[model samples]
Target: MALSKFLGLFLIHIALLSSSCFAADPFVFYDFEVSYITASPLGVPQQVIAINNKFPGPTINSTTNNNVVINVRNKLDESLLLHWSGIQQRRSSWQDGLPGTNCPIPPKWNWTYQFQVKDQIGSFFYFPSLHFQRAAGGFGGFIINNRDIIPIPFGSPDGDITILIGDWYTRNHTALRKALDAGKDLGMPDGVLINGKGPYQYNDTLVPDGIDYETIDVHPGKTYRLRVHNVGISTSLNFRIQSHNLLLAETEGSYTVQQNYTSLDIHVGQSYSFLLTTDQNASSDYYIVASARFVNESQWKRVTGVAILRYSNSKGKAAGPLPDPPQDEYDKTFSMNQARSIRWNVSASGARPNPQGSFRYGSINVTEIFVLKNKPPVTIDGKRRTTLSGISFVNPATPIRLADQFKVKGVYKLDFPSRPLTGPPKMETSVINGTFRGFMEVILQNNDTKVQTYHLSGYAFFVVGMDYGEWSENSRGTYNKWDGIARSTTQVYPGAWTAILISLDNVGVWNLRTENLDSWYLGQETYIRVVNPEVTNKTELPMPDNVLYCGALSKRQKYAKKSRFYVNGYLRKMAVKTNNG
Candidate 1:
């Protein structure tokens, strides 16, 4: 009987080994220590948040389906959370760093964020999600490479570079938070930064107070891929190199229909990649300009920031004056046209041997439609507040997910309207209840004078149609049902609307908010709660370990069911065979 059982177990272990999930995916690890360092990213020295003592934190690079584990140690005086911008936290919204989705990481405590970068590629970022900490630095780039079996859409470039551009304000995060709390506008930033450095104008001109200018050194006749991210708190900036045409390759995570432009407008929470060849004059450097758009120039202190592109054969200073933008500073039409130009490359493979999972989004049946509008800033309780429709979002006491899971009462209200309201402003939760596998068509209409950008947490929505004026049913006729680009973040023009199609396949409570941190803190955000029919751990992972209790969970004696991070039965046979071989 023992000999027979041993032979049977050996055969079973061999079969299980072939079928196990651990065969394909590899693990990546990171230890991030969040603390404050005194340094000058702009001209003046002040306290800025740093990760591993670096101004901009280290980069996290992985291929598709790779498991990334990051241990975040918070050393700030207050609670903080780090959000992965544009990452599809598939089946794992709990790892998403939105304030209400997951409890904040308290000071001196650490937590691990373990999630697979499933079915994603291209450029993205991570930043502090709460308390306006993004204003004081602490952001980094995240790049998901394609698997070795998957083919890249374009030819291989000689090198790759990441350029993080943003508008910089001298005020610390605490002051920014306090000002927003007092209902005041942040006005404008003092200058712009490229790769955490000040404007080129500040590199000198002051004795013992000069700042370093970011310069990209390269050899002539080589092609490079430049991944650009607008990591600003609030601002739409135009990026361009003085003497080169930017060949737009990809944006967000999807491959784009390659197009060439003199400049492109990148809004807050948006990212794009371009391919450029060092084909300019080798003996001189060229200016790289990033300037603010759609802001009052006279009132804004600084409008443009500069960087230099130096060639290996350059001899002296940059050749000529800074290049002019493709359009006037306030031309709305130009910005709209640029946004429309980005389309998905339907033939290019991403993540697998298929074109974005071969998702024919247009052919799917639409199960729901929602019209959400952004109202102009209004005074609420004597404080300037931003609202969606007639409601200003107020965070619930406990996370909506936990409240729903543990049967906690009154922790959140779920009657959020699906359309714009014509009533008085109400301060309450921003919970939009959704069904599992619900196919949705959402119209984000911005009636406010200023341009606005919106972002969803879990899935990349296809931008099908957009236009000026109210979005009528007839607007659906103008939709690009064929090759609309898919992205997690999108922009809505002033007095215009952007139409998107999203499939609610991922289940959990996700955050939908504006990328502008000021407006986000002041109540212009929402929680999208997607409920599956079955509440078992199969639909979504169970409560992760080491979750610090907050709100009602703190008063409870027992924690919720914990995650079973292992496979049973068959795995034991595999282990026994390996141990006795």
Candidate 2:
């Protein structure tokens, strides 16, 4: 018999055997109705696709590699598909759910997916594929691995805790889609939610039913594993327990060198597993704390969620709030110098609203800016543009012309503003010279001729070097600088920080050194790209850590428009990975 036919028969036989093991009573069929729900108290309807009307669908259990079957009935008007993230299946890429990989199941149509199980032993999550409709609010679930790579220290625990941190735009998921579709703007969610609930409650005096929240329960004397996943649109989170500590053991599905018992930081598209051993003798009552660490106005500062760690009478009593929450390890005051610095900024741009001027066709204009000094500008039109007085361009002509004239040399458009770089508008563009405050703000437009500009705060730059610029020779046959740093081979005096972006795609490697930076600024990041390219061979470029922005420069310029200085560059795929290599 063929392998396919044999597997189908085997699964049927196993299903029959499993059914026979149970009692004579009817099977307990768990039914879940998927739709959008809101947890935000703002009275706005946040669509949340859920099962059995629950934001997070019920859990599915079975032994690993078992023939697990699930009937997913779509009720929405759009087609839906599921994605088992990180799950590897041989010759089963058809079920990958990546759009364009195969035509997605049509609305109301049932597309049964069957594949052998092959995954690491741990907690995993499922989402309706990368399709916009499903992602907005659709199918989601947790996968538990009973097959253990290493036995649990305490054997199978009595219970498990899974904390999923996700964002909901109460108004309408369409609001977000519209923003992305129109090339408009989107801010961080207004309220932070944990387990589909928010914080802050109001009594009758303030406003009855103003806010209702839920907290997780924990017991003392018992060890618990916390599986934390951040599913916000795009934001890294720093979390801690209000009065207790945890032993962090794993990150991004990988084990740590040692159990790190401290409040930790986790970024989006990342996960962490922690082992908690409560104080057995004290009275039970502890709170779990998770907060967002965005540093810009447009970004949100949210208290994601809280859970109570309670113990049973058998274990003993728990203490009241363990001496005021210990200083968070990532506290800005203490961690300022210890943490490595990275260049970051929030940015946006535009293109003609006409149909032909679509972002996908590389016809939209884009601009990005950063808060720190010396960091190169966000790249657009194939290169980076730096600003001093308002949004000035650094070698803007090169990238813009290249993008317009050459199709193969297109630059990746990016936005990396963790928050809006906003302030009072004081400067205006001069029609005669196409300049702002004596500086050129190079504007790049789409085929439709729509233009965009960006600015950052408190940072100034001086031209350092350029690959196309004239530079001196080192006397020997070889060039002196690695890529682009000094203005010339003979003049290597820590080339002054310039408001210019060095296109990493072709430069091979480059450096952007900085000096004075705003005190309020923290690191910046975003998952933004204008182009979608297939993965290919390796390419070397300057890593974030080495792109230091502190240096000594003689000249300084002020913005007359009451605008902040900005750095521009396309958020290359390299910037998103912690370890680019």
Candidate 3:
């Protein structure tokens, strides 16, 4: 009887332990209704796509390892898909929100993205991934805090701040899309915006009675963590606060080596976190400036945005005059130096250096290399398209993941070339097949005179090297093999190249594309299919039941009525050949 009582006591202890663990990791939920909203960001009334009728959507805040459930309902006429920028969906690639991997949530349909933040804690974001809607603003901040047990590498700030820097256009989304489709560039933005509001300027002159600028209130002598994201469709922005040195803390999911800087160059689709200690004189306010860089550097006079950093104890709203901006936006020497200085904090207690995690990238054995080059503008199928390795990518009739999951054929081919294309551009669907868990080295060569930024979905790559000239086998010696920073997006200088090493640990069809929205729409993108040798519960789970299949896959049932033949669970209709019928 005494032994039986001891066993009961042991079971009770186990149950209490399990209950405490469950309480530590809680679920966070959000319902996002994407619809049209009328708001004036630049003092001009314009209709924009927003979530829950808010201009900048809603900010998502949660802790690491929490299951985040976001129910997105598309109420607009067009379809919608939200890309969780820098959130390495891990093995759950279906929630990556790439059009090639997951089908778009059609208009009037609601889809819930269920996934875990999982070992990641840093500054990230979410934005609409379809129909150029990101420019229209269905974007928001996605902040993940460290769990209770995990100690942050840096000191806790007194307060937290989030700023989104981007270029704003006066024209509507429809007008912008039509212009791009007509083989014309976006030219230039009306002005830059900080958190969706700034002085409306044209031709270097502010509009009469422009809207009030966005203000960030802070207490004196307190340090604040400022998380910034460059969510612009195009253009690189250099962000700075007058007379304050920024202590770099983090970038995306990796904790960076803390360094002090006056200005930070944030490329498109990139996010950064910096610590701003307000130890400056509290007598006057300061100016937070975000100026356009790399694009139209000659027209710097009209490419700047400003905001106010107000101290709580300041007397008046006088934010003084703007300080001198970065001397030269096109200074490649200065930009390259800043980029090289960003290194990974190897001693940080995170997945980056943990031997048990998937991000032990320092010891990875690279198995394959892909050399991609950006070619000159070329015409494909009577439309101007940006060439990537001679193949201007085109979206297939059906989503590639669905096609692959059902074993359907003809959606895409696996003959994408790894070497740079030699002569002319061609109309082709570039689909590169990859082996699961294989380490990959991607070299991006930019022969054009324009600077380019590239973003990869589902994984963050280590920025190993950025060379001035072309990339070759000899350039491998210049790689920063030890302390290179891991990021989801990187910039390639004009007439130069950038190399990154990534491990294909996530199984899904992922997209590697230019951050320039116009270039992406013009086919400067490709897909990598990471196929698992065996579909198992551990490697890749089965497709969720709620996945919405669209495009050609939806029409296959109608075609099956005419000609009945099953092709990999999908009905295939044969075409009847005739002489003159």
Steric overlap count per candidate: 0, 36, 0
lDDT of 2 by residue, 166-285 (tens): 554554555555554443334555554556555433223222254545456655567677777654444345566644566654432233333444565543433556777665444444
> Which window of ten consecutive residues has the lowest lDDT sum in model 1?
560-569
lDDT for residue 390 in candidate 2, whole number 0-100: 22
lDDT of each: 0.80, 0.35, 0.79
Model 1 lDDT, full chain set: 0.80
Give lDDT tens digits, candidate 1, residues 1-581: 49998688667544433332233676566777899999886768888899989888878887888767677778999888899998887777888987788778778866667677878898999999878999998999998888888888888889889898898888999998898887678877878888888767523332124667789988999989999999988888889998899999988889999998899999998999899988988667888889888877656435467888999899877744568766566665878878888998988877521233436887888988888888777887777788887678987767777777788888777777888877777788857888788888999998988778899998888999888999999999999988999898899988999999988888889888888777788889888789888766656766655455678886542342132111223333333343356
User: Is 1 or 3 the stronger prediction by lDDT?
Assistant: 1
- Report clash pairs, candidate 1: none
TM-score of each: 0.90, 0.50, 0.89
- Candidate 3 per-residue lDDT over residues 56-171, each given as its tens digit: 88889988877676777789899889999888776667888878887787788667676777767889999998888888888999999987777888888999888988888878
Q: In model 1, which regions exceed 4 Å deviation?
A: 1-24, 202-209, 298-301, 329-331, 352-358, 556-581
Q: After superposition, how far is residue 163 of candidate 1 from its true place, in Å?
A: 1.1
